[model samples]
Target: MSTLPTGYRTVVVPPERIEELRTVDQLAFAVAPDPEADQLLPFPVPHDRLMAVESPDGTYAAVHGSYDLVMPVPGGQVACAGLTWVGVRPDERRRGLLRAMITTHLERSLERGEPVSALFAAEAPIYGRFGYGSAADQVRLTVPRGAALRPVAGSERLTVRLERVDPGRHAELVEDLYVRAGAGRPGWVPRATPALRAYTVGDPPGRRAGCEPLLLATVLDGQDVRGVALFARKASWGEDGADAVVKVREASALDPASTHRLWSFLLDLDLTTTVETPPLAVDDPLLHLLVDPRPTRRRLTDNLWVRLLDVPTALAARRYAGPADVVLEVTDVLLPANAGRWRLVVDADGAADLSRTDVDADVALDVRELGALYLGGRSAAAMGSAGLARGDRAALDRLTTAFASSLAPVCPFMF
Candidate 1:
């Protein structure tokens, strides 16, 4: 690990200190322990990967952990160390404790053969300096009830069923449908752990936020389940009329018809004047299905931040759009080994071959920008225009075309 501040030290958290870990997080996030939630949802972060910073007196000052995740990329997936549950005591603010923990996190992740690290940043600006770039964006939309959709063939053949969500009975179905829905899309990671699966459908009464118990609606074709939506409605009576809002926790469908059928039910639910959607990819099928999208209130934000710990492995893990041979000069502040020039050679099959080279660079950018482009969601030309990357027009165009994805990258569920 890199040198830490004076009087501060880092250590791997032991199983015995699980309560201490939770304590630090509770204080850091200002959340009180909910017994009902604890009973329904499992804490999934592995104890072995947990790390903590301690004061000279042996008190825990900060803590963090990583989840062993397989992140989907264009045409494939890669081993990703998902940095999560990061927290620091209020008194420990601005002491470089977080930075030291992140340094250790990267080093240990690389040692474990994870080429990339990804996270849902609690605060947007805290990660850019650490070489984590905003790699993908997600948008949420609020649509009025009865919004019309362009018809998709076979949508009328599908049927709908609504029932209360039961984690034990429906977790596997939700997981299966989710995987099928996100096939071939970059950054569409699945919940691999059983705890995460349970957490996905967990709905403790105390956590409802005044809404009714969670409900699950499925689109079916005879015996087969094609799509599912988890949602709830909070009733409200306004001067105008009943202004109930349907808030969707998540919605996934396997086919175009299923997508159309699923939303048709969601948008026309009785008593709901507005339907709030979960964060969706820019190219989500629902967007294309909407007859008119301009009227919806759309809010966009960064969804995922990626750090390329092993640049070559990370780059090679995903398929490119078109074949290209270009050299890149990559600058990585934390990992000097990733610094310097490299050549990326691609073939007609979209496969990549990367290696260190002394050849003059065709493009120059930091590892952060490379991470942003890793999943094929970001464009090299945009980075160049933003001054985050430097290169000639030809090289920028080539890189952009090589890395372009037919579908937008999105993480449907946050870690």
Candidate 2:
């Protein structure tokens, strides 16, 4: 573990010190406090998982927290420490307080039997130095209102209803549809706790900047709910006419017809000129449903940054894609136990077994690259071509085939 500077120490943040922790993050992130929002939105992080660095004056200098999450992988799920709310006050910058806090977080997470850690990086470059790899990408689209969609078999029969979002009435419906929508996709993390669930549906007044109150759009077939979308419209007007924009917070659908029905309603809202989609997988169904996608504006961003704290356990947790017998020489600066040659053998059924090996490594790479490939979204051959991974050409091909996922990895919502 990295040592803290003299007279500085790591401490667990209790409920009473939650305000101090929030203050430190608000200062570091340069955001003003909104007490009204605080009352409406439940604090999502568990108090027991919050940690901070205390300076000599008995005040918090840096704060970080983790959520106990079950993250979906290629063929299964694993216990993941979703690292979040990390911040260090500007006055304490460059003092190694962040490093100390990270070490503490890693040790504590590992002790709790979590083999993986994932995060949505606020700043892209900072987490890479700490061994987190950019594992997935999400795209946001500004689709023109009234865009044409290719017809789905039953899309015409499904109906959409829009109403003010209610945690009491729509929380379970939203959560259930979200899980069903991303059934087989990697990195689809669900709201595992009540606090997280509440936060997802919470609509604090302070968060609405001139937009209408948050609304829920549900697609129904008879008595069954097939899809749900959380969104709001910001009113606007120009010389030409009403130029309102529909901003969707999140959307999920169970089937192709539901997806088509849901998006059709969102894209044709009254008085809206365009509809902004939430973070979507690169290969989202809506993209395929569109008759012409060239007119849509898109913004791509890194989605999940993954770090493997225990190499063998993490590797064994997720199934491989194809048959393979390859040895990887992994290097991890933060977790010394993970640095060594490990053999991964996958059977025809995609089950993998990773064990220590004395054999020559077929591929040699740092832990970051391995974590990036862990979800089966990244290609080993591409990494090798970029000189980020080193191995024979054929070995890289086999590794790529073994780790490939049918669907691109994505976490639709920020943690």
| lDDT (Cα, tens digit) per residue for candidate 1, span 1-415 | 3666788899989988877888899999999888778767887888898999988899899999999999999888999999998999998898889989999999899999999999999999899889998899999999999999999999999999999998999999999889889999888888999988998899998988999999999999998999999999999999988999999999999888999999999999988899999999988888888898888889999999999999999889989888999999999888999999999999999999999999899999999899899878899999999999999989999999999889889998998
Best by lDDT: 2
Which runs in model 1 stand beyond 4 Å of their true positions? none
- TM-score for each prediction? 0.98, 0.99
Cα lDDT, model 1, residue 124: 94
Clashing pairs in 2: none
For all candidates, the clash counts are: 0, 0
**Positional deviation of 246 in candidate 2, in angstroms?**
0.1
Candidate 2 regions exceeding 4 Å error are none
What's the residue-level lDDT of 208 in candidate 2? 84
